[model samples]
Each structure stands twice: as structure tokens, then as C-alpha cells.
Target: MPNITFHTKHIFSALLLFLVFGIQAFSKDIKQCDLLIQNGIDAMWEKDHVKSLELLTEARTLAEKNHWYKQLFLATNNIGANYYNLLDYGEALNYYLESYTIAVKHLEPKYEMIVLNNIAILYSKKKDFEKANEYFKKAYDIAVENKDEVKIGLYAMNLGNVANETNNLKKARDYFNESLPLLKSNPQFEILAKMAIAENDLLQKNYNQAQVTAETLLKTTKDLNYHDIGISLLMILSKSNFEQNNLDLASDYAQKIFARKPNLETKVAVFKLLSDINQKKMHFDLALQFKDSIIKAERELNEINNGRAFENNRVKFEIENYKKEIALNEAQLSNERKIFYSVLAIIIIVVFFVILTLRNLSVKHKQKKLIAERNEQIISLELEKKKSDNLLLEKMISEKETASLLEHEKLKNEIEQKNRKLSAKALYLSGRNELIEETLQSLSKLPEISNNNLLTNHIQTLKSHLKTDAEWDSFITHFEEVNQTFLNNLKTKHPKLNANDIRFITYIYMNLSTKEISSMLNITAEACRKRKERIANRMELSSEIPLYDYLSTL
Candidate 1:
């Protein structure tokens, strides 16, 4: 399960708004407390509830008890969120209920939705479907009443999650689809909704659609540097690919998942996928390896559980009781034995048992010697093999080093030549820019070019005169192809997404400022902003994330 995080988007926006308005305003009285609260929230996200509770408790105590409603509410919510992160549903329930009481009494609409939604999440996590749906409905109603567009989708998504958990998949799909239209241009929410939809598709046996959805999400999220979502998307795509019988792609994705440095469950899932792949490949040896992996995973879980399940020295008690049972039986037998003949027969039996034991020991000693001799011979051969392997490895390394040096020298010469070529190409680019400027200078100078085909042909002819003629042309063509592919892919994954939206996300992914993107793309700031806004509208990410953030999300 992915860790749920608080959206500090509100805080970030607050800061941005201050800058935009040139508000050299005084900080709020709760500034320290607010920072502490944020810290507590961050701690909770990292699952450090103890620290979160401590910080929240301090903040609550510092506030005016007489007017403690807001402080109490925030504290309770923070502590409850911490417990929720810790998966302590019972405790989390207690704290959230306290927070909910204050929100209801105070009628703080904003805080009310936050608390209610959190409670709903807790209930959902607990699998209390009835209660989960109840809180979700309440929160949704509040969001509607308050016209809180942001909170609305959260409520809907929460409901979708519950519906999914309860096998109300149709309802889940409906909920996700409903959010889709409302969240069209919002990259972050779209990612979440599509992820849910992708999961739903998988459940419905819509492997192809699910695969496309997951792959698109993986590529987008990976570009955005959203590590958490990227892994999830990759995992989903890997499974989808596996289902589609795209074994090689599935194997590649599975291997990436394996190398992802994941937690236990992720590793287990990856191992299972690999096991499946190997089984299909008829690699019985590798398939069996997953059995061992499963065992190891289970053992790790068991080790954690065993601390509470059994007492130390449990086996010793069982062994001692068994000895007592044997002794009691022997005493009873002694009482039943009545004559000298019985004693003589027992002695004869004991003697035979001892002689047989000795004979067996002698035979085992001879077998041991033979086994040791064989092992010694094997060890000697292995040693020779190891020596041969080391020698071969040394030779390979020497050859590799020699080749690397030669390649390095060759690359140095190529770089020197390429630099000169690129210098000439730069002059050509400058000249082309001048030509284009001159062409636009007068309508009569447009030449015979009427459309893209004419312009492309003109460019081809112009390319033949450049210093790095072929290379420049090739690079330009490749860039055009990649750029077109990027646009098409974005549009395909996001049908409503426009060029502005693509540029916005691209900027975010590139971590470029508006000025920087404008400079690079040779556009004005206003034009760039318009493009980003267009992108935002298309991607459905109008707020909570800016164009840059949205693009970064891609």
C-alpha cells in the first residue's frame, strides 16, 4: 500500500499568493505552532507518530484553552492522522471522533471536510464498509454544499477505494469515471483516477486497456520524478504485460521491478511474477527458486509473529515429559518382570543391541572415509578450475582495459572533429534564423512556399549546404520525430490534453522556469503562460498543481 500524504499544496499556494500580492505581511501568531503542525504532519507521513503526537501535544498545550477549539481540532486531527499512518485504527478512530466533534460544533466547513474525509479513510482502511460509506457521503455532501471542488474528488476517490475493496467494482468504476470529467486537466488527480481505473480494468479482465493505461502512467510518472507512483505504475504494467502474453516485455518490466529496491510486499510480488515467467519459460530450476523466495518471505513474517506465539525452551519441556513417560513405562515393566530367566533374556538382548550398534558404527566410519576422499578429489579439481577462471578473468580485464583506452583516444579525436563540425553547424543555424527573419520581413520574400510540405522540402535543401550537413539534417529530423511522438503519446494517454498542457508538463519535468522555457523555445513569457494554462485545462490540473508541477508529474 502507498503511504498517504497530506497535501502541503495549500501551504505552498499560500506562500505563492503572498509573493504574487507583494504581501510583506506580518506572520500569524500561530506561526511557530503552524510550522510545528506541518512538521508533525510530515512526521506522520514518515510513520513517526510518536514525534508527531509529541509535537501536536505541545502545540495544543501552548494555545488558549479557553478558546482551544481550533487548536484542539488541529491537534486531534494531527494525532489521529498519525495513528492512521501507524494503522492503529482503534486509536485513530478515537482521535478523529474527537476532532470531528469540534469541527461539527464550530462548523468550520474547511476543517470539517478535512476531518470527515480522514475518518472515512480510516474506516475504509479498517474495511468497515458501512461506516466508511457513511462518512464519505457526509464529506461529499459538505464538499458540495461548500463548493469545495478540491475536496469533492477526494471524497469521490475515497468512495471509489471503498467500493473497490468491497467488490462493488461497478460502483467503483462509476465513482472513478465521475471524477474523471471533473478532474480532466489536473495531471495529479488524473494520474490517481486513471490508476484506479487501470486497477479496475485489470479486475474486469480488460488486459489490453489496462496495459495501455498502466504503461502510459508508468512513462508519465517516471518522467515526473514521482518515485512512488512510478513504481506502482511499473508494477501494474508488468502484471498487465504478463497477462497479455508479452513475455519479453513482461520479463523486462519484472526485472526492473526486481531492481527497484522495494519493500517486502513489492519484492514478493516481483518474485511471483518472475516465478510465473520462469515457469512459462520451462526454466524449472529458476521456477523452484521462487518457492524458496516465498519461503524466505514467509519466514521473515513468521519471525516477527513468532515473538508473540511461542515461549522459549518449549521443546525442552516436551523432551523432558517424554523421558518421564519412558521412565514410568520402564518401572512398570520391571514390576511385571518376575524371574531370573527374564533378567537373563534382557541381558542377552542388551548385549546384541550393543554389538549391532558397534558394527553399524564401523561401517559408517568406512563410508565417511570414502566420502572424504571423494570430496578431497572434488575440491582439488574445483581449485584448479577456480585458478583457470581467475586467469581467464585477468586476461579479459587486460583486453577490456586496452580496448577502453583505444576507444577513449578514438572518442577524443571524434569529439575534436565534432566540435569543429558543431561550430560550423551553429553558424548555419544562425544563418537560417537570419533567413527566416528576412523571409518574414516581407510577404514577397515568402518565396514559393505555401505549406508544411514546401517548407520541409526547403529545409531539406537548406540542410544540404550546412557544414555538418547530414548530421544536422539527421538531428533535426530525429528531434521532430521525437517531439511529435512525445505530443502524440501525451494526447493518446490524455485525449483532451492540448499542446499547452504538454509544454507545461514538459517544463515541470525539465524543471525549467517560464523565462527559461520561453527562451529555449523562443516564445514570450505570456505565450508560455497561456500554453501552460491551455495544458492545465486539457490535463484537468487547473490548481493544486501549476503547469510546472503538473508537467513534472508526467
Candidate 2:
């Protein structure tokens, strides 16, 4: 070889510098895109749809140029959200589908789930509940596949909301029930699920129950500083009370919403509710005041709606042209590929025929030898087939045994999982009851509550409703149902165990730590351990064997 002395260090330094600079530039671009997206979202919230679209479009362009699928997805999806809020379903659906395409092609499945939800929401706004349910179920399935509890709860809540809209109250309740426990740690979604359940109750004409649920949720949302959720709860309460002919309570809720200075739609609804309430009371003058307010609010709402439609059309045209450009590029690329593949196929065909022709020329001379070899091969194949059949039968028998074992294990795991869920629910309820009790105690000492008989009575009623044992009874009922066989086996083996002992044993069998069991049982950790030891002593088990381990054998 020729003598070649390369400046390897210099080349390496140059490459390293290029890499570092490339990363910096890429990071800078993404930051800029993020800033644009945030500003676009802010603008959308401000109802400046035109400005929002301008910012989002710029971000989308940068994201697309750099192949940043996440940013591109956010920008596109937000634009769709803007259109959605403007009541432009057609434009919204187009942008949503475009984002869905990006998510499906370039991103992880979780991104696709996000787009699926958006598409479902758009269909929901269009009152296409069937299509909406289809997409919502797909998103929920993806959440299940990913083992994402938060999203599972969220999508389940969405599904339930849609079911409520479609008048399928039973199905709605089922979804909500499945969602609530999974969402217990997620206050935002848990509130939404509760709201949906209350809405379902309202739709089913269970007005008193709906009011109670909404009233409880209002307090929860208020404590969490969830202003919008509180407003929604207020609306539910207002509607439920109104349906029950509790005009005074309904008017009070409507006034609360009005005092919050909610959106024009809410304002219109409140104004109408107040007007009806006053009219029902024969206060014509007060009714006329609200009636006039409604007219003014409706006019403003109408003007805004008309303006949004015009602004949306202008933006829609621009977006449509941009899509057409992308489509044209894709069409050109596809056609080029088709031509390349066509030529390659033709070349392959020509080569194949040449090979076939040569093979035919040698066929006669080798035919007799080939036939003699084939006879020997046929005898070998028959022997192999007999061996294969025997092996196949053995494999089938083995697979059947394996399948039965697997099914038994699956059922056991399912019961264990159900018990775990029940345990979680118990813990949640325990914590919630403690918090409620503390709140009542604090309120009882407050001067305002003590001085006011009505407030004190309300507090007393709330205290009466706080039946800690009732919740535990419900939990035990469910736990017993899920772990029926396990419980029966344990009882049969330990007939001397009492109900409380069995409860303790049940907690131990769930593999809960000492602290968790203590909290659930309202006892200290030391006491919980003593109780465990006592139970073991009663069961006549050795000290070396742990309670959980002993229970597991059962």
C-alpha cells in the first residue's frame, strides 16, 4: 500500500465539533418550537384564534423541517383544538386526522392514543356518538395495553360521558365505576369521572342523588382549587335541583355561577335559569331584568359565533392548500418508487426466463437419474412423516397440559389483582374518611359554624354520613366475593378463627406491609404486628413461619 499519514486527531476533533454544534442547533430549534406552541395555546385560550393559528403554523413548519414529531403533533393538535372550540367541525376533523397520521407514522403508540381521543372528542361535538364511542374504545384499549392507569381512567371516563350522552346509563355507570378507583390518585380525572356519574344520575331523573353528588363534588373541587370543575358541578347541581322543583336552590346555584363571571354560554344559561325562577315566583320585574340580560348575552354570543365562522373559513383555506402541497409531494415520491420497482421487476423476469431455458436443456439427460433419486426420497419422506406424526401427538399432549396450568395460574392472578384493587379502595376510603373527620372537627370549632344553627346542623348531618364502618363493610363484601375460594379454604383450615381475626388474616394474605395494615385497621404499626402474632398463635403456627407465608400455602 502507498504510504498514507492521516491527521486522525484533527479529523476526530472536526467530527466531534460538528456533532456538538449539530446537537446545540437542534436543541435550540426545539426550544423555539416549544415556546411557539405555548404561546399558541395561550392565544387560543384568549380566543384569538387567528393569532393562535399563526403561531402554531410557524411552530409546525419548524417541527416538520426538523422532523420533530412530538412538537409537530402538539402544534397540529392544538390548531385542531382551536377550530374545535370555534365550532368548525370540518376544519377541526381535518387537522385532527392530520395529527393522527403524524402520530401513527412517526411516534409511539401513546401519541396515537392522544390523537384518537381528540378525534373522538371532535366526533362527540358533532353528536356522532357511535363513531365517538368507537374511537374512545380504541384509545382505552391502547391505555390498557400500555398498562397506564391514568389514561385508562381518563379514557374510561370519556367513554362513560359519551354513553351518558347516548342515553346508555347502565353502560355509562359501568365505565365510571371502573374508572373511579383507577383515578383515585388523579384528582383532575377523578373529579371528571364523578361529574360524569352525577350527570348520568341527572339524565336518569335521579335528581336528589345527583344534587347530593354534585354538592359533595363542589366542595372537593373548591378545596382542590379546580375552578372550572367547581363551575361544572354548580351547573349539575342547578339542573338537578331545577328538575326537582327546588327553584330557590336552583336559582342560588345559577347565581353562584353568574357571580363567577363564567363564559357567555354559561351566562346565557344562568340568565335563563334565573328568569324562569323569578317568573315561577311571580316576580315579573326581576324576571324581565334577567330576560333582558339573556337577550343581550345571546346577541353577543351570536356575534361572536358569526365572527368565529368567518375567521375559521379564512384559516381553513390556508391549511387546505398546505395539505394539498404535502399530498402532491407524497404522490410524486410514490410514482417514482413505482417506476423504479417496475424496471427492477422486468429485469428479474428476463433473468428468470434465461435460467428456466438452461434448466430445460439439461432436463432429459438427468430425468432418469432424478426419478431414481425421487423414489428413494419418497421412502425417506414416509419414514420421516411417521416420526413427525408421533412427535406431533406428543407435542399436542404437552401443550394441553401447559395450557391448563397456564389457565389456572391466570385465574389465580386475576383474583389476586382484584383483591389488590379492593385493598387500594380500602386505603383510599380510610384516608378520605380521616380527612372528612378532620374537616368536621375544624369546622365545629369555627365561630361562624358554632354561631349558626343551620351550619352546625349541616355539619352534624355530614358527620352522621361519615360511617367509616359502612365503607369497610362494602370493601369486605367485594373482597370476599373476589377471593371466595381463598377465604373458604382458609376458614376450613382454621375453623377457630373469628371474624376480626379473619379480617386481619385477609389483610396479611394481600401482602400489605405492617404500616398499611395498621392504617387500614385504624391501629398503630406495633399493634398491627402484635395482632398478627396473636393470630398466628391462635392458628397454632410456628414463629418461624410468617403469617403471609402461612396464608399463601392455604
Candidate 3:
């Protein structure tokens, strides 16, 4: 007993030591993960993108290994930012999407808004204004739903920018106006919104208003040393003055933009404005020089855009491969976990049965004769009990079969009732559509209705509503309840059958006539018959077999 106790104490001590070491190792990994992430962010800020990616990738690996979602989100989002800075928009979008998925699944809505905004910015950079608008609107809606004032202000600023780019000046003004108050705490964003409003005025050809606004912001930018904002204000001032025929002032503002060392896009705009200003001033040589500079800047911009386009397609394929790899890893991990649990359960069950068997074997010798006598009596009782149990089981099974049959019959009746209701609904929709079509035809034949725009629009609206799918959807719901396995069995057997083919097959299954189906589907009877044959051919069924008969068999 002492030896057993000593061995148990040793085992417990080993387990305790292992647990302590495991905890230490886990803490070490967390600390290392955080260190790597912080270092990666520093590298990104320092413009060492390659080093940033390396460190962040290491952190991502560690975070994923330990299921650290927050660290993973940060790492992934920063990786996207790095790619974005490099003009690899496709790769940036891919990582942003990954982080977006992680945020949606494991993090808060605020994180989701961050990734959504990043994705919108990528789309905006790629000149996909429509998609950019969509994502920006989505992020804005989320911010509104969360009542996050900061996010609301930020996203509102973004939406305003998108609206201005798309030439929706009124909408841009509204968004800016909405954001300005909300972003009062954020001076930078407030200035950005004010700048956007100035740009909006310029775009709308309100030259006086634009010049006044830009001049006011120009002083604020100078006072705050906001060089980038100052450059933008200069461009707005240059354009506004040029439009007002203040050529000398425009030239001075454009030249100031050059001194600011603005980005290539801003430089291109400035060069174009300078060229136009020189041309208006009758300085042909100077205009030609500025035009050449514009050409060079535009060529560089095009190269960057083209590079982004190429990377977009390349990264699509890369992301697909990455997804496949992730799926495979998850599958392997799941299989490993299942195997571990299965082995542990088997070990426990085997140990329990072995101990029980050994205990039984140890008692068998002393109780051998008595056990034999008891076994005889037990066998006699078991024989009697088993016979009685068999008889009861037989009776129970008979009763169960009767109950099952009654339940099945009742279920069948219910299904039949649902099918009848579904059929009636389909027929009613068919008749209603037919009636609307007849009314439309009659209306079209009337000269008074055909000549008037209002009447014509009403007729078109009626036609649009005539072929509504809502009733068909309701019918399908009832039909599915009545024939639950039919669609599944049909799909399993005829995998190539499309949705339209399935809908036609469903009508045939419900025993609806061809004319009824045609009216319900807004097609002719001949088309319906052809569709039926086409579906049968797609199913690879023999032409000799009727479609309805084949369906009934299924």
C-alpha cells in the first residue's frame, strides 16, 4: 500500500510539474506573440514593409496556433495595410477579407467596421466606385446601428468623399454637413470634411464660394502645419481662381503646390492646371513644358494602376490556394482531435471492463458450486421470463405497427391536404396572371391609354407585378412540406438539373397540367412541354418513360 501510494504521489507530482511547465510555455507564447506584433507595427511605421510582414507572419502563426483572435485580427489587418501601402490592392483586399471574417466570427462589431472600411478604401483605390460606395455604406450603417460616434464621423467622411468623386455634390454636401458636427472632437477629420465641402463647391462651379472656403482652410492648414491638407487647399484655390479668370493668382497657387512635394496624383492635377493657366496666358512654350510633365506623371500613375490590376488577379488565385490549405489544416486538426478522444474513451472503457472481469474471476472459485446451483434456478426463471417477454414483445410490436400505420395514414392525409392547397394556390396565381395579361392587352389596344405617358407607365407597372414570384414561393413552401424528400431525391439523382427544371418537375410531381404550369410560369404550353423533355434528357432518363411516371417512381 505504501509503495502504491508513493507511486501515485510521484505520478501526481509529474502531472503537476507538467501543468506548471505548460502554463509557463503558454504565457511565454502570449508574451512573444504580443512582442512580435508590436515590433511588426513599428516596422510598418518605419517603412520597412518586408520586415514588417515577416514579423507579422510569425505572430499570425503563433496566434493561430493558440487561437488568439484579437492578435490574429491585428496581424492580418496590419498585413493588409502593408500590402495596401505597396499598391498591391488585391493582396490587401484578400487579407482584409480574412480579418473581416475573423472579426465577424470572434470579435466585436467595431472590429468588423474597421475591416469593412479598409476593404472600401481598397475598392476606392482600384477605381471601383460602385463597390466602394457599397462597402462604405455598409460600414456607415454598422456605425449608425452601434451608435459609435467616432466611427459614424469617420465613415460619414468616407461616404462624403465617395459621393463627391461620383459627382453627387448635394449628397456629398449632406454627408459632410452631417459628419462635421459628429467629428467635432476630431480636428483632422473636421478639416477634411471642410476641404471636401470646398472641393464640392469647386466641382459645382461655385467659384467664389470655393475660393473663400479654400482660402480660410489654407490659413488653418498653415497654422497647424498640415502640409497635405494645405496642398489640397492650394489645388482647390488654384482651380477656383482659374475658373474665375484670376490667372496670376491661380499660377501662384499651383506653383506653391509644387513646393509642397505633394503626391503624384496631386502633382498631376497641379501640372494640368499650370498647363491650362499657361495656355490661357498665351505662353505656348511654358504650356508645352507643363503638358510634358503632366504626361510623365500620368504615365507613372497608369503604371501603378496597371500593377494593381495585375496583382488583383494574381492574388485571387493565391487566396484560393490559401483557403484550400486552411481547410486541409482544419480537417487534419479535427481528425486529430477526434482520434485523441476516441483513443481516450476506448482506454477508459477497456480498463473498466478489465477490472470488472478480474474481480469476477477472483470470486468464481469460492462460489463455484453455489453458483452452479444458482445458475440452474436462474436459467429456469430466465426461460420462463424470456418466454413471457417474447409474448409481450410480440403483442407490443403488433400494437406499435397498428399505431405506426394510423400515424402514417394521418400524415398522408395531411400531406394530401397541403398539396391540394398548394395546387389551388398555383392555379389561382395562374388565373390571376392570365387575367392581368388580358387586361394589359386590352389596355394596350386602347388609343387613349397607349398615348398617355402616365397610363403607359401604369400599364408597365401592372405587367411587372403580373409575373410576381412571391406566390410561387409560397406555393413551393407548401409543396415542400407535402413532398419533403422529393426535391432532395431529385437533386441527388439528377445533379445537372437547373432551378427552372426543378420547378417544372415540381409542377409535374404535383400533377399540374401543362397549361396550368405555363400560366403559372408565364410561358406557353409548348415551351413547358419542351422544358419537360429537356429536363428528362438532362436527367438521362429513357424517352420511352414518361416524366411524371419516372417522378412517381422516385
TM-score of each: 0.46, 0.50, 0.56
Against the reference, the lDDT scores of all candidates come to: 0.64, 0.78, 0.78
Name the 10 consecutive residues with the lowest summed lDDT in model 1.
308-317
Better of 2 and 3 by lDDT: 3
Please report the candidate that would top lDDT against the real structure. Answer: 3
Error of 3 at 41 (Å): 1.2
Query: What TM-score would you give candidate 1 relative to the actual structure?
Result: 0.46
Per-residue alpha-carbon lDDT of model 2 for 422-516, expressed as tens digits?
66565444443444455566676777775799987877775664546676677779987997878899889889999899878877777777876
Clashes in each model (backbone N, CA, C under 3 Å)?
Answer: 12, 0, 0
Show model 1 residue runs off by greater than 4 Å: 1-39, 42-49, 62-64, 127-130, 222-227, 280-282, 301-554
Candidate 2's clash total is: 0
For residue 335, give model 1's deviation from the true position in Å. 82
Query: Judged by lDDT against the true structure, how good is candidate 3?
Result: 0.78
Instruction: In angstroms, give how far residue 142 of model 1 lies from its true place.
Output: 1.8
Report the CA-based lDDT of candidate 2 relative to the real structure: 0.78
lDDT, candidate 3, 1-554, per-residue tens:
46447856987999999999999999999999999999999998998776777788778877987899999999999989988876766668889999999999999998999999999989998889899999999899999999998789889889989999999989988888889899889888788888888999999999999999998887756443463887888889988899989999999998987787888888878887897898788665587577668667766766665565455434433533444454456556655755565565556556545545554564445345544555565566556556655754665576556556545644554565566556655655665565556557667788787569998888787678565667567677777777879888988988898877888898888788888788778888899889888888888889999999999988
Task: Give the 10-residue window scoring lowest on summed lDDT in candidate 3.
Answer: 312-321
**lDDT score at residue 235, model 1, on the 0-100 scale:** 74
Candidates 1 and 2 compared: the better one by TM-score is 2
Error of 3 at 260 (Å): 0.4
Candidate 2 TM-score, true structure as reference: 0.50
